[model samples]
Target: MRELREYLAACERDPACRAVLLTSSAGPFCQGLDYTCLLGLSPDKRRRAAEELARELKEFVRAVAGFGKPLVAGVTGACVGLGVALLPLCDLVYVSEKATLQLPYSRLGTVPEGGATHSLTTLLGHMKAGALMMTGRAITGSEALSANLATGLLWSATAYEDLIAQARQVLDNAAQIQALESTKALIRHSLRAKLEMALHSECRLLVHQWCAPEFQQRVRDLYDGGQLLLQKPGFDTQ
Candidate 1:
């Protein structure tokens, strides 16, 4: 999170950098968090760690939201948990045919992170966002496009190797338009304060939830049942 924020800050300062493209290497864009380390922490330490994590997440999301340039995301594969929640922060999202988005927060015994609690409702409406958060459902790329979550759907058998290239081409084409940055500012101005408040509330609630006894019990239950860390099995202390 610190690295990402620093890079974005550098890009924002560099006059040559007109826009930024966010993507991962081949395979799943982001498989989601592995809770082994956090779940393993002692009660007191866990609370402190959760508070730190909440602060980092809030700062990272704020950086993304406040970016002046176009922030485009190319999703080549599965985007899960916090990854799926953060997609709405990107200015444009292009997803490959195989790209899948899932918010498993409810199953993980946590509320939405990355300001999705408010942004998803604003973008996808109450019922759609509620169903997704309540049920841990997965949505396909085409479905996301249709639902207005994705800017476009990319189809390629090569795992969308050229996804970044396509995104760059689109941005380059749009560069000819007048006052792109100013126009983006105008579009985002009204919602900035609301989004900031939403993020603050979401992070506070998450910190409190993470420290609760129920959340700890739920994590243990999921881990014991072989549900947690099934996709990505590794401890992450950072």
Candidate 2:
């Protein structure tokens, strides 16, 4: 998160950075919180920690959503939890055909954070959002494109580089590009006020859910089993 913040700050300062691309290293974009890190914490400490983490996550999403310049996300593998949430805030998203996206908060007995519930519903609608939360289903990149979660789909990781090149080519036309970006800014500005309210509300609910016994039990199950109980099958290591 600190690194992401620093990168964004640099983008803010650099006039040449017209579009910022976000992607992970070798593994999945992110598996969300390191459940192993939370395994040994007491209930109270866990609750407080979750609250703090949720607040930081909310701020990050807000920053991405309101960034004056366009933001791009390249998702290669597991894009779950806050990963799925944060991508929607980007102006454009590209995902590998093999990538899987999920929102596993309900299965973990915690409320959705990072403005996922609000933002996802706005993008995917109430029914699809509810299905995702309730079933904890993993959707493919092609499915994500169909659902409007992804703007483009790549056949392989190699293809992702080509897509980035294409994106850069389109952005290289400064005058035409700047005009389109200005229009986008105007549209995004109109939605900013409501998005702020939704983000704040999500933080509040997440804090409360973090303190709940059900959520604690879910964490305990993951700790005791050495893996998250509700994790999607193929991704579980243990």
Candidate 3:
């Protein structure tokens, strides 16, 4: 995540960088958090990590959402949890036929991160957004396209080059790139402050929820059910 933060920071600061492109090397864009490590930290350490993680998430959202350059993502496979939370931040998204998006926050006994509460509602409307978050449902690439979450879905990865070329064009042409950036800022300036506040709220809520008694019990359940690492005999989860 720190690497991602640095990359986004570079995109914002580098004059030569006019556009940002995100892609995954792994089979899935993201499989979501490996909660096993987080669920294993000592209570004091867990609290510290959760607090820091919340701040990091807020900073990440602010950096990505406010990036002056056009941001494009090429999703090849599965995109779940935090990955699903991220789609709404990009200026454009292209997905492969196999790409799948899911939000499993409730299943993990937490609420949405990545400011999805506001971004999803704004992009997908109340009904659809509620259905996804409340029901913990996932959507396919084609379904994402139909839902306006993706610009397009490619049948093959060979088609991904075209999207990359399009993003490169933004970086290659200075005047056009600046114009696009200025236009984007003008359009989104008013919403920036609101998004910041919403992200701040999400971070704080998540910090508490992650360390709460219920969340501790849920993690224990994972261990008891053999879903996590070596279990400790006694810990005041409450």
Candidate 4:
């Protein structure tokens, strides 16, 4: 979080940097939290960890919301949890044809983060947002495009490279226009304040939810159900 925030700030200050493209070279883009890291902590420590995470998340979203340049995201694989929530915040999103987006907060006994409660509702209306947040359903790239979550789709055959090339092409063209930054500022001006407020609320809720017994049990259940894998270099569970 700190690294990303610093990079964003640096980019904002750099006159040569016009726009930024966010993408992952690895598969699955992002799979949200590694539950294995949290599952072993005692309830008290767990709550502390959650608080730290909440703080980081709030600051990260604030940076993203305040960015002056056009922000584009390219999703090449599964995007879950925080990944899914981030889609609505970006100025333009491009996804691979095989990409999948899911918000499993309800299933995890938690709520949305990254100002998703406000952003998703604003972008996708009450019914659609409710369906996604409440039910934990996975939506395909085509579905996301249809719902206006994605600006366009990339062919899976060359999705990663295509997304990167396309995002650069688009952003480069946009950067050439002198009014792009001002236009973006105008577009985001009204939404920034509410997004910050929503981020605070959502992050606070996440801290509380992560420490709850139900959420803890759900993590255990996920492991038992073969949904999560425990990596090595295990921490002390005491």
Quick one: best lDDT, which candidate?
4
How high is the CA lDDT of each candidate model?
0.77, 0.73, 0.74, 0.79
Clashes of each: 0, 0, 0, 0
lDDT of each residue in 1-238, candidate 1, tens digit only: 6777888899899887878877765667776655554677888898888988888888878888888888778887778877777788777888887888898888767788888888888889999999889999899988888888888888756535566666567667884533777877888886677888888888888888888878878878977886655455111110
For residue 32, model 3's alpha carbon misses the true position, in angstroms, by 2.9
In candidate 2, what are the lDDT values of residues 2-58, reduced to their tens digit? 457656878877887777877754457767755543345788787778777776776
User: Better model by lDDT, 2 or 4?
Assistant: 4
Q: Give per-residue CA lDDT, model 4, range 92-204, as digits (tens).
A: 88988789898888888888888989998899999999999999989999999998889999888888778767767766676454488788888888788889889888888
Give the RMSD in angstroms, all C-alphas superposed, for model 2.
Answer: 4.7
TM-score of each candidate structure, all chains considered together? 0.88, 0.85, 0.85, 0.89
Write down the RMSD of all candidates, one decimal each: 3.7, 4.7, 6.8, 5.1
Give candidate 1 misplaced runs (Cα > 4 Å): 158-162, 175-178, 220-238
Q: Output the lDDT of residue 5, model 1.
A: 82
RMSD over all Cα atoms, model 4: 5.1
Rank the models by lDDT, top first: 4, 1, 3, 2
Q: Is candidate 3 or candidate 4 better by lDDT?
A: 4
- Please list all clashing residue pairs in model 4, or write none if there are none: none
